[model samples]
Target: MGSGTPSFLGLLCALLTLRPGSGFYLPGLAPVSFCPAGSSSSDCQVNIQLFVNRLDSIESVLPYEYDFFDFCKDDQEKRPSENLGQVLFGERIETSPYKFSFMKTETCAKVCTKSYDVSKQEERTKLEFLKKGMQLNYQHHWIVDNMPVTWCYTVEDNQKYCNPGFPIGCYVDGNGHPKDACVINVSFNEKNTFYVFNHVDITITYHSGEGEGWTGARLVARLYLLGVLKKVPFQYLWDYILVSMPHTNIQWFSIMNSLVIVLFLSGMVAMIMLRTLHKDIARYNQVDQEEAQEESGWKQVHGDVFRPPRNGMVLSVFLGQGAQIFIMTFITLFLACLGFLSPANRGALMTCAVVLWVLLGTPAGYVSARMYKTFGGEKWKTNVLLTALLCPGIIFADFFVMNLILWVEGSSAAIPFGTLVAVLALWFGISVPLTFVGAYFGFKKQAIEHPVRTNQIPRQIPEQSFFTKPLPGIIMGGILPFGCIFIQLFFILNSIWSHQMYYMFGFLFLVFIILVITCSEATVLLCYFHLCAEDYHWWWRSFLTSSFTAFYLLVYAVHYFFSKLQIIGAASTILYFGYTMIMVLIFFLFTGTIGFFACFWFVSKIYSVVKVD
Candidate 1:
């Protein structure tokens, strides 16, 4: 057959499948049954009308087709029923006989009707008529901006049906319903609703067969509610289902705005290195005694510049921890993008990150021990212990305090005491021992050799510009790299606190790559300028330059809590920033390590490449 013939045949098949009454029930004619009080059978019937609100192009954020039906006996129990047959094809299903009552009218009037007498057909018919008399008033209201919503449920015993999955809310049927009967509810109010677009269904089809035999199909549902109307009062519906508003996308422009300042600094550094310092260095050696004495800028820091940095052991530990965090983050994001730690798997992402970091303690120990030895630190044992405990201890202490609050509050977000103990076991039991092993190997190796020899006395740094001073320069260096990532951070925070599903791994990975590039380039460029300025104390400064972004992140966290968040009480604030500090500390180490290594390479290469007689 010709290509056109195949295409035509496929279209015909699709049309047949999609046509009304072609295996799928018509929209409005779908039957909804209600069981009257004390009646074992469903004695009432009503039609449920499905309507779509405003439509928008951003359906990926909120997708739910109008015709997708949810099944449950009450407002507290909702479950997707459209594909129930497929989901339970081979499963032995069991349901208790419970009275299912439905009321279509806005309000019920007491008619003093006797308890449903199922034995009498006349009484059953009369009850059915009364139920049918209740009219369902369809508002057909359109919501433009969808409200954020959450699905809450509980699982008990070993029964299968008791566990209702995602996009479905859950509640305990406290009215003496079967213990295995899972309850669910969907709300659209600003406080407790899943934001679904009103009127859109998107389907994606793929030709899976190679050479004309492949076929694949996927369907997405969407609903849009107006942002303003979401707040309007509605009696029958819940006021709010979610605790907070759905998080907005990361403001890339705001991040870019901050980055512009860093770029400007980079340009300034470039100008000094290429134009001003190059000539000054060349001219300094050739000048006579008087002119040499007047030598300024970075030219003064030739001696004592490369002296082993103070607290080298601590610095090494910091770098090691940072390296561990960086690798963990990279792997976690990669796996998440690949769909390993998706929303379907609760706690998977954190579990993955923790496992990976614990296993990778070898690298942290190796890097710290090697750096410490190079810094002339002879206490390998101290280095290894510090590497394993110092930073992690600080984080754990903070975490324990936060956990205490969570335990008191009884929030599901709290880590159980057993889990906390397990984390400690992972750290001290697994990670600590691994660090010692790595340190043994690192110390056995020779110290890393520097390309340039250190002068006995430090060169005096010349008076510097306001922007080039240590604090200002270091602070400025972090902005560019942080700018590349703050937008991505917003989404991450939302996924954590707002409980939104974050599946856009592609965008996140791109942002991660951008952050690494920005950190490296910005640090290298600044290190070169400092070296040319004769201020060779680029060791800690280089690390701090990029790491300072963590400070800004902490500031933002504070601002978010005070301004954007409705979280109350000191405990919440303390818990929020305490956990935030752990994040910042890890981030500090990661970014600092990136800058250090980049500067380390730049310093070694530039000095080694140039003939230093």
Candidate 2:
């Protein structure tokens, strides 16, 4: 096939697979190895191993790696596959003893049993931790063939809630309230003792070769571990796969909605540059000196427009952090879109982001120092320190506070002191040095040249209309950008709060692109209007205008919490808002920088083209 033909074919394939009611797996899906629960198949030699991830509680902020729990170890020292993100997230997936081959069956067989004597101090300590995990409702995350092993349970009447991992056990209180995974079984009613699940009934289901284009049986079912036989009749389900996958129609709607906003913004920006600005430039160049004196609009404020803002240091630092975050998010999302950071790889997403942010500190410091120098600041040390520490310190402080809460509650989600130290080391050792390097280079380079010269005396702006007022303009500027993202935001929130797997990063990546364009165009358009209105304070206005989108995100999150989430309790609420605040701040920086740069470019381009004496 020709190069163009392959590209066309790939596009066609993607479109076909994304159609509603289509096959669960994409076309040309690579076959994964699988064996029956008890039997081996010669067709595929890939050993099916159960890999365990960190144990986490929804109520907590810390997550413990699989090794933290003293459970059955792998027969060999072989560690399961993991990506960079997974490693950073402390996912320690090792091979499990329970192995299977294709087309096998075993009926309620005993995998292993643990009988711990409480008299022994070492064993008792381990048991105590295990019991604490049960009390805190920390869940196990098991993966087989890169697919999560789901534990399906009934909740909300007939609605079935299938968790990717089941708890090791549950604690029943004196009040007879079955907590965590114990609700699934009445036999777990022993008041104080941990009813550990010593055994599991494994079932493997696969699509046979009889399916249209498939050559061999492909595993379609997520491995499920039924802790107790008394819970329900022994039955395994593969039907949930079709029901659980995100609906393609909803994705298309989101894409279409974003496209409309993008197209509209594109048209408005094009009109301003091509028709409005073109004519203004032509008129200014042709008009006599007598006529020029009467024209006191954007042209009149040219000298003061590039005047440094009051808090140039702070703005430069924010822009630097924003640039770092922007690049990190873009690369992370793009990798996710390409399936490099798929949900199957535990913690890979966060791992990649953290690693990227650390490595990209150079750009962060460079942007800050360069902008600070442009603002005629000589304090390079202060500029670089703020660039490296300001935003990151705030985030770390918030995270540490959250972690402290988790520790106080004895939740498994708290980060260990060792891990915390390691994180600090990465930040200070790697990221801090990189920022200094970037700032050094940036300072060594000359400050950016503005197209128009600035006057020593600042211009006085006329009283603005309500629509052109700073607050109103900033508020209005964010609406379009927020509109483009609200749909995608729903899924992101669902992934975080509702514990749903997010795999539609392709859609997310597309939405991110749309958001950037929407933010840029919206800010540029608003900046143009303000400039034309004789407002020379476009510096801070442009940044605030796009950054206000974060406020809408906060609003929508509040709406999502009250409307969609069943989350209750002060701890959960506090943690939710705390994390949301961190996200909002980062987003503020990211979007604000985009708007600032866009407006800067627009101002420079327009001024350079017009005839200025």
Candidate 3:
């Protein structure tokens, strides 16, 4: 192990060195100033440029590029300083028409005017679309110095809410009800007409050098400007999530908690296999006449232990999908851990996952076909087709239904018809054929060899006690696995719902390894106990045992929704649970497959080793 350590480190360094930005770096900025377009004033050097991202509404899933809104365009090509994650997430930040100089105090200054002639048909159409986006509560995400320009407002209880994005403009209804943001100014009172916000009052605040040791000024405030077009830009954290936590406390806490659970379970399993099982094997090997009648435990049931399970076709299909998912997840997380899929690169994580899943159909098919054949299944075509279609079909149907809801609600989150077609093409055109190829190869391969001969008659399993019952054992099996992940799950949930940045892939990878270990050990320990109680039916039980962890995950998510989230609305609630169900199903298959294989190996090894006449 010691000799291999240096070689492993050298290889890791080489891989990371070959990949650009595959190592951690702190975010730093060099201050620059801007004066009037041609002015040479040294005091007014701080110039800020606005960048635009896709315009999205809460009611829809489709996001349009900045150009689609017909907003102010930049004169020159200047891209913002973005990280790998930001780029991969489709954040097309570029120079904008709006410019500002560093200001010491909060003073509203006019930035620019966006006058447009509505007489032209093209201009009118663009204006109408922009107004419709505002009517539907579409938000504009702006970035300055890599920080979100937040819109701050007072809500109920006099508490202030800071939204990372601001509205384009507001529309008042014919019935005299002014929109929410429009109520802030009397200038936006035109009924049944789109009031364009053509002017913005900019406010900037900065910390002077005297207080924070900065040589000049540091922008520290998020501000908003309102007009007939109000623009408010409030500065928020850029990369403090990665650097500024309470200093490794959360990571250590999560690690310690998982370690405690893992150590406890590992101790239990170790005691059972090393001490109890060793003695059991020794006593059974003696085979004295006095103990011959008492051989009704696990040793007596060895003849039927290797029997192929009922509904083996479905089980094999799940195992194949599980294997595919396992490989994909491992590679994805490994890339992330190595910083290749760092949060700096926009959309890379999802893109990588989708591409990997598409390319992995062969493994799924191969594993499913091989396992099905081993189970004495004769229907190769059905097995392969089901493996290709079943789980993916279910997830797609759910996603399509959700998309329909988004369409009806007019939310920007809905998938476009073109994108949907492309997805289907990828699945049917590429994935299905690859799965068939894998299945063909899998079917051609010989079935796996068993260690012992099977009995002609299936042995009758004795009635199991409470401790050894399937339900109880499976329920207990999930506890440790869930414990290992619940901490990391919190951060993941935060990143998705709370819009917090998640950049700790190293910690996440560690947790994944722990989850695998916990699931395997817990399942194996329970499988041994069940077999000792003479219950030879373990195929389904072993799979379901660790898969039950997903149930705990669902429960935790529900608790999180009510306890941690302040999200209101039936649509949001429905969307949350709908997506969560998909995650739960995938996790169920992944963890359950790990447990099943571990138990399979353990049972095979122990039974094969004992001397059976």
Report the lDDT tens digits of candidate 1 across residue range 270-323: 786688657765676577767665655444454445578988988999988888
Model 2, span 1-613: residue lDDT tens: 1111111110000000101121244322344643334444565443555566667665443566666667765557477565555543445666665655444444543444455566778866766777766777777777666666666656676665555566666777766677766776666675554565555545555555555454445666544444452443221222364365444578789889989989999999999999988998889999986898689778888789889887899999999999999999999998887777766555868988999999999999999999999988898999999999999999999988877776676544566797789889999999999999999999999999998899998888999999988999999999999999998899888877666567778889999999999999999999999999999898889999999999999999999888887555677677788889999999999999999999988998899887767
CA RMSD, predictions in order: 16.5, 10.4, 12.4
Off by over 4 Å in 1: 1-303
lDDT of 2 at 29: 32
TM-score of each: 0.60, 0.79, 0.73
lDDT of 3 by residue, 1-613 (tens): 0111111110000000001111123222343333333553564445665677666554433455666676756667477564433433335566776655544232343333344456677766665667666676666777665456656665677655555566666777887577756787776666675554444555544444445333544444434445444334333434333443332578779988998888988999899889989888898888874675577678887878888999999999999999889989999999888767764455668878878888999999999999899888999999999999999999999888877776676544566687678778989999899999999999999997767778999988787789899889989989889988998899898766655457778888888988998999999988988888989999999999999999999999999888887655677678778888889989998998899889989998888778776
Ranking by TM-score: 2, 3, 1
Between 2 and 3, whose TM-score is larger? 2
User: Judged by TM-score, which candidate is best?
Assistant: 2
Off by more than 4 A, model 3: 1-49, 54-140, 144-239, 245-247, 288-293
Q: Clashes per prediction? A: 40, 12, 42
Predictions in order: lDDT: 0.53, 0.75, 0.72
Q: Candidate 3: lDDT of 452?
A: 75
